[model samples]
Target: MKIEIWSDIMCPFCYIGKHNFEQALEKLPFKNEIEVEWKSFQLDPTLDAAQPQNTIEYFKEKKGFPADQASQMIGQVAQMGKGAGIDFNFEKALIINTFTAHKLLHLAKKYGKANEMEEALFKAHFIDGKNVGDIEELVSLAGNLNMDKEETRQTLTSDQFDYEISQDIQEAKNNGISSVPFFVLNGKYAVSGAQPAEVFADALQQTYKETVSPFKDLSKEGGASCDTDGCSA
Candidate 1:
């Protein structure tokens, strides 16, 4: 089974949800058979670097949520992350145009270091307070993962993996994605939101059952919501 996750690097819930989903997969019976492919979904495709606002202020201003409310939300998310064994320094986060990050991710995918690069980016932004949009930061991340720094820098500057990023975005649009942390299981089941770990575990167990017992019957299901357009058998 394959799990396709459409998520953004700067989205706190996406980071927390990633950890929760990973934990669920770790304990599932069919863990070895499942393959995870992280898809690109930029929360801000048109972020102007000139303004350069912090993430908390950005969300508060954009969503009309109070600053205190936003802080509480981030605090809850960080707590959830801690429960999942990941620490999220929501304070140090910056609003980044994730297009270039997505491109670099695809470049990392080519070298089979995609997961490492994703983890590095998450750490860089949410933990280390690094500027993920900068080429220097990206090259440093790639070098740490043993990738060629010069090649990574050139890829970031030039049109490297642009096509891949476009295609992934198009796919997300076709699926009617309106949020990050969206997950598609086996290209059949769609789940939306930063779901609880139990919800994610249930999803994997269900997918595993379908894979192991194809002839077994199943039924329509409904949770809080689906990732995009509603999922069916």
Candidate 2:
């Protein structure tokens, strides 16, 4: 079974969703058979990467939320992160453009390290408060994954993988997805938002049954049998 997840690295719920989804996958008997692909989605595609702003301030200024409401919302998200085993430090988190970060992910995908790359990016931004928009920071993260440091730097500096990033974003729009942390299972089943582990587990099991499991023979009586000999009915 294949699962494609469309998410933005800056989105708090995307990290939470990733953790919940992985937790569900860990318990599945056929977990090894599952293929997960992380797709790119930008919540703020036009944000200036050169001038990153505080996450709470960005929410208040851009989204028109009051100061107290913004803090409350961020606090709620932090609580949600804790529930998913993530320590989200919004105070240190910055709102920066993720276009370059997404390109790095595409490069990592070529090396079969996209999942690892996504996890590292999430931790870098939400936990460690690293500037994901910075090429050097991204290269360092890639190096930690054993990816070639120079190749990663070149890829981030140039337009390499930009096409793949755009394609992923366009595909999300084509699928009517305007939100982050959206999951598509077997190109059919979709679970939106940061749902609980049970929801993901149920979706995974259902998709596996429908797509990978053998068909059931519902015939009560033996209707026909054919082997290397004559058929019987």
Candidate 3:
């Protein structure tokens, strides 16, 4: 079975959704048979990378939320992060454009390290509070994954993989997905938002069963059949 996840690295729920989805996969017997592909989505594509802003302030000023409401919303997200085993330091997190980071992810996908790249990006932004938009920081993260540092720098600096990011975003729009952490299983099942592990697990199992066994045997006894022999009943 194949699972394609469309998410924005800056989205808090996307991180939590990733954790819950992985937990769901662990509970499945055919976990090894599952193929997961990470797709890119940018919550704030027009965000200025040059001028990084405080997450709370961005929410208040850009999103039009009151100061106290912004703080409350961020606090709620932090609590949700804790529930998913993530220690989010929103105070240190900067609201920067994730376009370059998504480009790096496409490069990592070429090396079969997309999953690892996604996890590292999430950790950098949410936990360690690193500037994922910076070339140096992205190259460092790629190096940690054993990807070629110079190639990573070049990829980030140039317009490489920009088309891939655009395609992913266009595909999401085509699929009627405007939210992050959206999951598509076997190109048939679509699960949205930061759903619980049980929801993901059930979706996975149901998709797996249907993909592997699409037919139901309703007959009490075998009908006439032909194999190597001419015919048999």
Candidate 4:
């Protein structure tokens, strides 16, 4: 079974959804047979990487949320993250363009380190408060994942993987995906948001069964077939 996840590193719920989905996978009997691919999605593609803002400030100034409301809203998300074992420091989190970060993810996908890259970026932003939009930081993060730092830098410097990132976003738009943490299982089953572990587990199991495609003969009589009673005469 294949699971493709559309998420943004800056999205708080994406991290939580990741955990919830992982937990679901853990409960699945065929977990080893599952293939997970992380797809890129940008919450603010227009934001300038050069001029980053704190999360609270972005919510207040850009999204037009009152200061207190912004803090309170983020606080609620932080509390939800805590339940899923994420330590979200929204106050220190930087709100920056994730285009470069998403591009690096496509690069990481080539090296089979997409999961590591995603986790590193999430921790870097939510916990360490590192600026993911910074090229230097992205290069450093890639290196930490044992990826070729120079190659990663070069890829980001050029227009490489730009189409892949854009395609992912375009596909999301086509699929009516306007939010992060959207999961598509086997191109059929979809689960939105940071649902509970049980909900994800159910979706995973359901998709697995639906995709298995059980063979049905529909014939009433057996025709020269072998069975537990031995070959039919």
Tell me the spans in candidate 2 whose CA falls farther than 4 Å from its real position: 214-233
Per-residue accuracy of model 3 over 94-166 as CA lDDT, tens digit each = 7899999999999999999999999999999988889989999999999999999999999999998999899
Per-residue accuracy of model 1 over 161-218 as CA lDDT, tens digit each: 8887888888999989989889999988988988888999998888778877867635
What would the TM-score be for candidate 2 when compared with the true structure?
0.94
Best by lDDT: 2
lDDT: which is higher, 1 or 2?
2
Clash count, candidate 3: 0
Clashing residue pairs in candidate 3 (N, C-alpha, C atoms within 3 angstroms): none
In the range 26-67, model 4's lDDT, one tens digit per residue, is: 988999999999999998888997888998789888899999
Clashes of 4: 0
Candidate 2's residue-wise lDDT over 1-233, tens digit each? 89999999999999999999999999999999999999999998989988889987898889999889999999999999899999999999978999999998999989999999999999999989899999999999999999999999988888888888889999999999999899999998999999999999999999999886557768879787888988988
* lDDT score, candidate 4: 0.91
TM-score of 4: 0.92
Task: Give the candidates in order of lDDT, highest first.
Answer: 2, 3, 4, 1
Residue pairs with clashing backbones, model 2? none
Local error of candidate 3 at residue 87 (angstroms): 1.1
RMSD of each: 9.1, 1.9, 1.9, 2.7
Q: Rate the local accuracy (lDDT) of all candidates.
A: 0.83, 0.93, 0.92, 0.91
Candidate 3 error regions (>4 Å):
216-233
Candidate 1 has an lDDT of: 0.83
